[model samples]
Target: MEIELVNCECCGLKEDCTQDYISEVKAKFDGKWLCGLCSEAVSDEVKRGKKSSFGMDEAVKAHMSFCGKFKSNPAVKVADGMRQMLRRRSGDLSSSSSKKFMRSAST
Candidate 1:
């Protein structure tokens, strides 16, 4: 098999990749790999923080919060799943959450 050197779809960073690198998002995201810096940018945005032109934007974070909320409660699902798909397609949903949210969400 030819090894793949896909660029980090989040920000076009590149590296040798395998399936193990996919983020554990809402279980339906499909996109290319993300380098460390771009990944951080996306992560910050997903957490509902201020948008950084040097980093991810606030719009990205709000969209992720919307996805998270929808995933946690099917009855309260807002917007179609298409939003999530679009974000993933654009490689924009890779932001990491703060530990506080992670701890609570995992529980």
Candidate 2:
């Protein structure tokens, strides 16, 4: 029942989760806790790696390296955030502009 702040071993994402939840995640990721997204990615990697010699540990390490690369790039992170924001607001932006056009036309 106690909530604790925990950081994902792979991505360093912080989440306030119950102790039980943290333990569960750690147990799943070879005793290293991963965030939900990282865990899913690792799971997918494991499934795909079945064709080769890859396993859970390898997937976790590969994902950790991938996340670490992104952490070192501030510009990429900003650009990515802006891109996501624009994508989400695109519909609103378009509709608002159309409304402004209609109002001007009626005036």
TM-scores of the models, in the order given: 0.33, 0.74
Q: Give RMSD to native, each candidate.
A: 19.7, 3.7
RMSD of 2: 3.7
- Across residues 1-104, which tens digit of lDDT does each residue of candidate 2 receive? 89999988877777899999999989888999887878998999999999998999999999988888874443346568999999879978999999999999
Which pairs clash in the backbone of model 1?
8-13, 8-33, 42-95, 43-95, 43-96, 45-61
lDDT of each: 0.46, 0.86
lDDT of 1 at 78: 26
Give the runs in model 1 whose Cα sits over 4 Å from its true position: 1-3, 23-32, 50-107
Point out where model 2 deviates above 4 Å.
72-97, 100-107
Tens digits of per-residue lDDT, candidate 1, 1-107, equal: 34466654433445665555444321223342445544554665655453434324443444445434532432222234766778776664343345557888899
Best by TM-score: 2
